[model samples]
Target: MNSVFIRKALLLSAVLFSSVVLSQTQDEVKKENPTVDFALEGRIGVAVGDKAVGINVGGPSLKLKLNGFKIGVGAFPSLLVLDGDAAPRLSVSPIIEYKKWMLITPYYGYDAEKKMIWTFGIGYKFK
Candidate 1:
């Protein structure tokens, strides 16, 4: 009975020691390579294509940055000021940012005529 108790105690100690060592090594690895970051960004730009011409207002966008490049998606509400008439619609687009410049492509949305359109635009990102 005493031998069995000793074996169980040794096994528990070994498990605890290995777990602590593994956690410390993981923390060290994280410290050595801290390259990813996240941020909220907003942008405004003018878009014109097909039957869509408008001002894009994007905000509260979640961005993932790795190294020097950033990638994200934003839902932008566009104010279409076409032919002296104004209307509002939402567009979701993929955003690519480098430094302070932003690129929004395949800016897909519906026009005042309820027709699908694609537009692309460049703008500045606010930090």
Candidate 2:
């Protein structure tokens, strides 16, 4: 009876090991699949020292393969609030992204007064 129990334990161990190895092999193959593509990223970054709140919205932006690139527009409005009146200060930035992550854009933005400003930044893929 003891010998039978030992044999059963060994068989179970062998089966578990085989399953793990097979899974690893399959994962490697999937990684090398050329047809497989992924593009989806979302990040929250801050710009300090400007004393202004920055909001960036960029994601699944797509690479040059699709539409040559994607667009990323950001806005920063003044944070002043007073007696049913708010000072409006809006800034717009249009960015071009590559591979749905690498954001390489030179924007012609404007403030509430329509003043022009330049903005540039880089991004990373997270998917």
Candidate 3:
């Protein structure tokens, strides 16, 4: 069990570090072509479902803005704190953002127990 946790922690760290590097590269590309609109932002929010309510953290979203619409996908690591037993999970969801408000639907989450769950969430994004 300890080994599993350590592995997960390491994997998460690598993902986050890679995302930051990717975001920086995108910024440089955007500077060269002003027509391309790309953004990376942090998100934090709460999710609730019939079985559980959880807090979402480390939600790094890569977004594209066209006209007035923003669309993206985010990977959220969450803690299901209100469930029968607290569990850590990762959720990947399609995201739509207007201003700072974010809507996440069909949030597909995979937990340590290898259970898959679908839920919906609302969140705020930080610029």
Please, what are the lDDT tens digits per residue for candidate 3 over residues 41-123?
67786655546566786566788997645788878888775348887777787776655566664354554576555555566
Q: Report, for all candidates in order, the number of backbone clashes.
A: 0, 1, 0
Winner on lDDT between 2 and 3 is: 3
Model 1 lDDT, full chain set: 0.62
| Candidate 3 ranges with C-alpha deviation above 4 Å | 1-41, 106-115
What is the per-residue lDDT of model 1 for residues 1-127, given as tens digits with 9 covering 90 to 100?
1445445544554454345434543232334556976666666866555445668887557689988668888788887665567777677777776666666644555545666666656656666
Q: What is residue 41's positional error in candidate 3, in angstroms? A: 7.8
Instruction: Please provide TM-scores, in order, for all candidate models, with all chains considered together.
Output: 0.55, 0.31, 0.55
Residue 98 in model 1: lDDT = 65
- The TM-score of candidate 1 is 0.55
Show the lowest summed lDDT stretch of 10 residues, model 2. 44-53
lDDT of 2 at 117: 33
Error of 2 at 22 (Å): 34
Per-residue lDDT of 27-59 in model 2, one digit per residue for the tens? 323366578687654643222111123333443
